[model samples]
Structures are given as C-alpha cells and as structure tokens.
Target: MTSRPAAPVPATAPAVPAAGRLAAGEQPVLPLSGELELRPWRLDDADAGALLAAGQDPDISHWNLFTVGSRAEARDRIARMHRRRTAGTGAVWAVAPRGGAAIGLAALNDVDPADGSAEVAYWVLPAARGGGIAVLAARRLGRWALDELGLRRLTLRHSTANPASCRVAEKAGYTYEGSLRDALAHADGRHDVHLHTLVAG
Candidate 1:
C-alpha cells in the first residue's frame, strides 16, 4: 500500500486502556451522534456472536482476507488486538449503539507513536449498512486518535473499487491525497487504493 508520511509523535503509547479489559477504567470512550459509542472489544457474553457474525459476512471476509472460522478463532483474533495495544502498535474498538449489539468496528492500525501517525479503519455489518454508522464511527475514532492520543495525523485508504468506503473516508474529514496504483494485493488480485489523510494542527 502507498504509505502515508509519518508525523512526529511521542515515543510512548497513550496510557489509554480499552473496553472489556479489567483495567477498563482507563478505557477511552468516543461518543457519536445517534447514541453510538466506540469502546474496546470486551470478552463479554456477546463477543462470540459478534465476532462470528463479522467473520461470516461475505463482504468482511472478502476484504479482510483472514476471517474467523469459529468462536475460538474469533477470540484469538481479538486477543491479538489487545496485544497490539499493549505493544503500542494498534487498537480496535467495537461500535455499540444505545441498547444494541456491537454492530461494527472502528480501529487504528499501523500506529506509530514515534511518528505521531496511524491509519484509521471501520466497517459496518450488512444489516447495519444503511445507517451511516461507518462515517460517524470512523470520524469519532480519528478525532480520538488525534486528541486523546496526541497523534499528528491519521490516514484512511480504501480500495478504489469500494466507493462506499471512499464516501465514508470523505465524510469522516479525511481529504483525498491521491491514488496508490496497484498498491495492495488482495485475495482477488492487486488493487489500486485512494489515500486520504487528516492532519492535526
């Protein structure tokens, strides 16, 4: 993929704990309009079903390449998210609306605290697609990463074929930078990507 230039960052991970862990008191909470909240993935009763649904979605599986095949596998994947957070590389969150199941995910990947930059991503379940949750959730996470984590910038890129994701990136305030021609190799083949970014003042 076309890598975004890094912005300078402190050489330490933010002391923010995420949801579901016992140290959740330090978890950062991001509230969105219409009552959606982004929190750390919990090892709660719903974790199995939630992650299974995500893994089973044809769209999610197609895009992610590595999808969970069982509840155990789902748990393991989430554990890796937690480990990444501890290592100060990345963080993932479950998108929870008021009185609803965690219906989507918002995350920062390839985080570089030393560079003060990260890549933001989000996805909504098929059943949840029409609600515009993706844009709101992604915007919330980007803001949190910039504000709470003291990041200098965030990059968001999507395959050129995914127009819906491009819309989400634009609406989330990431300005289109340019295209990365055949930057990523997916299950189907290499794909071009549209790169977008939002820089902190």
Candidate 2:
C-alpha cells in the first residue's frame, strides 16, 4: 500500500487562569485609618440606607449614574455586590467609621484576573465630602488590590467636568494619563473623561 501524509493538528489558545485570589476567600475589611475602614457591604437597613443616600445625592447620581428607588432595591444591589465578589468580577466596600454606618463606597469594578487589571470607583456622602475620605479609601483599596490581590494595573476614569474627582485620583497616587473624548455619559450629556492609572511596582 502507498504511504499517506499525516494531517496537522489545529492550534488552540492557552486557557486563562481563574481569579482564585478574589474568589478563594471571603472579602476582607481594609482599614483606612483609626476611625475609618473599607468593609464589605451588608444586607441590613443601615447599609441599604447608605446606598439610598448615595443614589439620592445629586452629585453621586450625576457622576456615577446610579440610583436605588427604595430600600428593597438598595438591598438587592448590595446582594449583587456580594455576588460579584464571589464571582470574581468585582469587589466593593463600604467606607465607614469603625462600628458605624457606611458613609461612602469604594470599588474595584471589571476585575479581570486574566488581564490582572481593574477599575476604581468611589463616592462619599455630602457630610463626608471635603474630608479626604474618598482619597484615603481609594488609596487603601488600591494598595490591597495591587499588593494582596496581585492585580498588575488599576485605572480610574472620571468626567473632566468633575475636578474634585480628578483631585481624588491624583492624591490617591494615580498618574494622570490623558483625556478620552466623549468617553463617559452623565446626566447632563456625554463628556470627556480623564484617565488615570496605577501600576504595581
């Protein structure tokens, strides 16, 4: 019999590693200072109220484009936050004084273990504004994400119209990269966004 040529094997992409660091254990409580900490959100009335307050705040709603109509909705959102942590897609924390109610939020959204990256977001209540809480919470959370979680890069994007947020990003050790034209849509309209980044050393 005549010899036949062998067929070539098809190529395949390498498999991505799962986000074991984020999903392997319970979310941790990160302390910002003696009085403040970034802890996991609870499904209780007080935490729900914090979400409600953030939704009702004109600045937070306008910038973050988030709103909860009622306590039930807020609780649902809180539950989703917990679910995301377990799913390794996100990690969110409530910024609170020790043994007190949440007064703000800090989050690492769009967590991608394969890419080793995430985006940072945060907002503080009106009463907590102007006290550098946002900056502190952001810095603390960024440290944990980079050092503990082993993420290589973190990005922060904010509307150019919001200078306060820009300040927060700067003070939190993020380097200003550049602006993206019409990158974000706010309540007013589509706006340019400033991109800031922090890379693990």
TM-scores of all candidate predictions against the true structure: 0.84, 0.89
Please list the C-alpha lDDT of all candidates, in the order they appear. Answer: 0.79, 0.90
The candidate maximizing lDDT is 2
Error of 1 at 187 (Å): 2.2
Give me the overall lDDT of model 1: 0.79
* Model 1 vs. true fold: TM: 0.84
lDDT of 2 by residue, 1-201 (tens): 988888878876333336776977789989887799999988884444888888889999999998987898998898899899888999899999988899999999999988888999999999989989999999999999888888889999999999999999999999999999999989999999999999888
For every candidate in turn, the CA RMSD to the true structure comes to: 8.4, 5.9
Question: Ten residues in a row with the worst lDDT in model 1?
Answer: 16-25
Superposed Cα RMSD, model 1: 8.4
